[model samples]
Every structure is written in C-alpha cells, then in structure tokens.
Target: MIDIQFRREDSNIMSVEMSGHAEAGPYGYDIVCAAVSALSIGTVNSLSEIAEIPVEVVSANDSGGYLKFTLPTDLTQKQMETGQILMKSLYLSLKSTEEEYNEYLRINSLDGK
Candidate 1:
C-alpha cells in the first residue's frame, strides 16, 4: 500500500511525503522508482509551469521507500490550487502503480502453476 500526506505550513508553503511497501516482486523496486521519478519531475514541472512556484524534492529514499517535497513559500491562491492538483496526481499515480504491480504478481503466480 502507498500512502501520501500533504501538509501546508502556510498559504504559500507545503510539504508532501510519500511512503509505501515494495514487496510485490523483483520489479517492485522498479515500479516505486518510476513512480518517484515521475512524481518528482511532475511536481517540479507543474509548480514551475502551472503554478509559477518553485518546488524541490527535499529527500528521497529507495531502501526505505519514501519521498518528500518542499513547496515554494510565496505561492498564491491559484498556486495553492495547482499544488493540490499536483499532489493528488502524485498520490493517484503511486496508488495505481501499486495496484497494477500487485495484479501483475497475482497473474504471474497463476501462470507459474
């Protein structure tokens, strides 16, 4: 399971954390890596292009399977809305990837019989 939490320090700054287990198969780590890469890139692009706000990937850990983001501190209301959209997109992407990986494992197990 993948969990994402978003915390707003003020109207302009926010923090996001993503944590989950990677145990589906050999490709589990790959899936997680891809998700993290996509999220990091997507968040930076979204904030810069859509929100015009600066964002950074504060820390990332593959062994422990966690990622964190620090949002800009001068965001406007529109930028905040954009941040919410980006966060939701990242959360959904992680969740759907996990579900897909789990389903792949199930199918692989069945085929191995």
Candidate 2:
C-alpha cells in the first residue's frame, strides 16, 4: 500500500510525503503508482519549471518507494500561489485515486488547521 501524508501549516500545504508501492499490478504496470507519481512529480516540476521557484528540499528513493518535498520559505506571491494550486490539484487527484483504489492507498492530512 502507498502511505501518503500531506503536511499542512495553517490550512495551507507545507509539505508532502509518500512511501510504499500501490502493488495494484506488476512493477511496470501499476496504474495507481503511475498516477501518484505523475501528480507528485508534476507538482514539483510545475512549481520549479513553471513557477520559477525551486523546492529546496526534495528526496526520492525509487527502490524504497519514497518521495518527499517541502516548500521553501522565500517564495514570492506568484510562486506560492502556483505551488498551492498544483498541490491542491494533487490533493484532489489523490482523493479521487483513494476513492477508486482504497485497498492500495492511504492518505492522511497532518498537523494543519
């Protein structure tokens, strides 16, 4: 199962962490994992590439099935908005995924109002 946690700060997303595999199918054929990966990686890319604000803390371990990212403190208003939009989009996508693949995924929102 995939354990995904969204850390919030004052109702805003502060960070995101995900671990484990969906195991919905074979390694190359797990649609759940692929969808999750696309959301997470796409969020990062959008924040950095499109928003021009690079996330200072990002880690990934393919073999261990882990990925984490934290928003930087110095982002400008536009960048922050961009990041939040992408993250919220991710949250919605993951929520939908959870609804469809509840057996292979778990999502938790932590420490944010």
Best by lDDT: 2
Scored by Cα lDDT, where does model 1 land? 0.59
**Which regions of candidate 2 deviate over 4 angstroms?**
62-64, 110-113
For each candidate in turn, the TM-score is: 0.56, 0.90
The pairs that clash in candidate 2 are: none
Q: Per-residue CA lDDT of candidate 2, range 37-90, in tens?
A: 888888888877887877755556547588888888777888888888888888
lDDT of 1 by residue, 40-102 (tens): 577777877887777777554546656667776666878888877876666566556646665
- Global lDDT of each candidate: 0.59, 0.84
Candidate 1 runs further than 4 Å off = 1-4, 8-13, 19-29, 60-66, 102-113
Error of 1 at 64 (Å): 10
